[model samples]
Target: MTDKSETAQPSGLPYAMSAYLIWGFVPVYFKLLSHVSPVAVVAQRVLWSIPLLLVIMAFRKQLGEYAAIFRHKAHLRNLLASATLVAINWLIYIWAVSTDHILAASLGYYLNPLVNVLLGRLFLGERLRPLQMVAVAVAAIGVAILIGDALDTLWVSISLALSFGLYGLIRKITPVGSVPGLATETTLLAPLALGAVLYFAQVGGGGFGDDVTTSGLLILAGAVTAIPLLMFATAARRMSYTSLGFVQYTAPSIAFLLGVFVYGEPLSTTKLACFILIWASIAIFCADAIKSYRASKA
Candidate 1:
């Protein structure tokens, strides 16, 4: 059985912050690889992550745990589904960053926590507090505004939110450790990733060996992919979901700053309006969470 007490510890805050900070800065990394195809980048990310994860598993002496997980058909299926979702998320994010749609990608992540709350209510029979409901409704309004004003790129945000939300939901219910589970997901994806790399290489389009700098960056994707996830898993184990949800905003917030200040994505009036509503919704959500947490403590 999962230990509920583990989620309430304050010590996990640093891990959570570290994970979000890394995630927030990820667009910069992807931007450096903008010359490469999104599919190729994602393939490289998946392929490279496997060895790094394996090494971590060996160091942690969890290789046996990983082997044992495969024995369960259900766990394998869940991981396969999660692998698909995460792959889609990665591809979309890479494409968005590469195509100068970082703002849209950032909006997607901003919407993800609300999506998670909605998912919890729908699938887990969790009750949403009144503030939570209001937060969701406000976020919905923001999304609607985006749809009305910038329908062309709205799908990017929506797809990213849905894919990642579903991925988290699956992983939440799956009875596997985060590292092992990620290893399994990458393992399932490795064949397709390898094929993609080979195809790109054959076509003289692979970024892997085209230059020393690009090759190194592509390899670094492995650490970039693995480290934050491990930290997130650790944080999830050590902190309440409410606190984690609050911290999750740090990533999108940084991405938003990067999108506006660094990448120079336009902040048109409509987009600005949408962001305002979303931020308000997040504020409301956080306030409610804090209130409830305090009440529980008292």
Candidate 2:
């Protein structure tokens, strides 16, 4: 059974902030590994994280949690789906950052929450507020304008939004906690990651460990992936979903800044207009959510 603790709520603020901060700066991290293959980076991140995650799980004595997850067939299915979506999201993101397509990456993440809103309306039978309705519509307009110039990048944005939105939905329904859930997901995918590492190594492409810098970054990737997840889970347990929605924007906002200034990616007027509209949309949506949360709390 999942333990519910009132005490768990208080310690979550730092973790939540840390998670968002780390996530916001991820463009910088991947930029370091730009020369490394994105697929290989992701594969190693998944593969190398297994042992570290396991050690953490053992230390936490959450093996019972891990065991219980596998015992529930429905939860197993959810984890698998979540894993697939997250892996795809990660791969696409790494590629986008490494290839100087950070602008497209920013669009994808910016659109992800809106995608979740649509999914909630369609699948969860949630009703949208008036502001939310306008927000999404405006965001759609923004997307259309951006797509006019670079239609080819639309798939990247769409895929990132869809996969991540779906992953969030599935994760919300999962019974397992963060550490164990991530451990199990990574564990399930570990063998494939290991095989790929070995195959690429044999072919002289060399695995992450072949180079000191690459290996170090790969290990860091595991820590990076696991830590935010743990923090997000902690925050989720304490905070309202609406607050989470608001905090989620911090990541992409930082990514946008990094893309514009650090990566030296050109931002055309059309793309700028899209981002402005999207930001306005997010502001509207968050205002509505805040009002709703206050009303419910009161």
Candidate 3:
């Protein structure tokens, strides 16, 4: 039997688009929870996601398979690391949005694919194409441009990029289905999440029960967080990696617009220059991906 994910199917287009769009607009949802502590928000996300994902696994009758993956101690170990990385990514992203560093967050994501490319070369022994090398260097300069003007929040961008990039690397090497892997990660983090709830409540910062709207939104964080991830995994199954890569920019682009235009975050000339450089890098990188994909097909 062959892996379905290795083949391209037109139907995957909708799933890919839907996933990226939701991810793009997700800042809006997190922004709504601005009053909540980032820790509390992430805790709610992890706890709520457990139940929903378990239900999804059960509905798909993957419960047994999910359980079997854990029997491998190696898988368990890698998943623990992946879980930690994802949790870190979630916290930084929320903090960035609430503190008006959405542009930094946006830039982090804009640089993510490039980060992945570099990681692939570094860890997976993949060779970087000429354009890809240029893309990476260009993105680095874009990041370098921010060291002076945006030094204060530059950590947010780099942390987000590195953490998520590493998380993807771990997941790519770990042989498991996306949903199962995610369910396991949440399970591992459940204890930490519960501690966050208890600690926050003790300090009177847990915002879940503060009001009806807040509580409801916290509960729904599961949906907002898990759905797009699941959709993306599904889409990845039916699309070529290169094709999927082409659409990966949608989320950051949307978030960038929301940061500047919708939420009125100021964009400085220096930051604008960085974005332009990153965009140019993406163009070059994407052109390379297109050519490589076509060559493989030929």
Candidate 4:
């Protein structure tokens, strides 16, 4: 079971396919949980997810990773902050999907790359190339085109994207592995989640069982959240960044299709134009990434 063969790339097809397909289908799951409040849903997701993640980590004897993390004050602080950012990101996404704002959610993810670019320049002190700057500018225009009176949801999308992008940046700099990092982050927030669940129950929110069906859907959110992350971690370790980044878009594309066709969300001419512009930005971004990657190899 040890993957020590240098010549053998781990079978990336399973990891990539599972992550993409599962992420693509996320809107359906959130739609099913529409009856539940977004806060409640997120609480349940985080609280319920901890046991599953912990059990897996325990079985793999990775409790030591958790111990190691707590010992490092710098890593611990960053993990807590990153955890909060991810929680906000998750809550906003669920709210958007539940309220039939799937296109907006898709737009957030589409803009995520540009947000990452900005963060790289601002925090990491990395410089962007001219084309990279143009790509980000085009993406901003695309986002503006999509913003038509849905100011609240649009802000939510932008905030979530930027927050998660920065969270990712911090996570990369933190001296922790994916599993341990996620576990610690989720662990830190588990108490708040548990408290919310209890408070909601007392307020007749039905907590975990407001409706049996909704409850089931909420539990399923854990698997939904965990699976893609696992796959992404696997894919990141096994494949090139270029390949992984390209595949990452599949989720949002699937979401766009689900939003426009299946969910019957409006794809106005303006929104369509926005989508096109964003896609063009992605094309430019990818070109730069590929060039950079190749240059490094050379």
Best by TM-score: 1
Give RMSD to native, each candidate. 2.3, 2.1, 2.5, 3.6
Write model 4 residue lDDT over 161-222, tens digit each, in one string: 78767776766566565566777887899899888888888885533776677777778777
Question: Where does candidate 3 stray beyond 4 Å?
Answer: 1-15, 234-245
- Candidate 2 residue-wise lDDT, 106-143, digit = tens: 88878887887787788767788898899999999998
Q: Write the per-residue lDDT of candidate 1 for residues 1-298, one digit (tens) a residue.
A: 2223334554778988999999999999999999998889999999889999999889867788788878989999998998999999999999999999999999999998888888878876768999999999999999999877899999999999899888877777776777888899999999999999989989866799989999999999999988997787667656544456678899999999999999899999999999999999999999998898899999
- Model 2: number of clashes? 0
Winner on lDDT (1 vs 4): 1
Instruction: Provide backbone clash counts, one per model.
Output: 1, 0, 0, 0
Question: On a 0 to 1 TM-score scale, where does candidate 4 land against the true structure?
Answer: 0.86
List TM-score per model, in order.
0.94, 0.92, 0.92, 0.86
Local error of candidate 3 at residue 85 (angstroms): 0.6
Pitting candidate 1 against candidate 2, the one with the higher lDDT is 1
Selected candidate, larger TM-score, 1 vs 2: 1
lDDT for model 2 comes to 0.80
Cα error, residue 134 of model 4, in Å, equals 1.9
Q: If the candidates were sorted by their lDDT against the true structure, best first, what order would they fall in?
A: 1, 3, 2, 4
Better of 3 and 4 by lDDT: 3
Across 77-131, the per-residue lDDT of candidate 3 in tens digits comes to 9989989998999999999998888999999888887877777788877788898
Report the Cα lDDT for residue 240, model 2.
Answer: 42
Model 1 TM-score, 2 decimals = 0.94
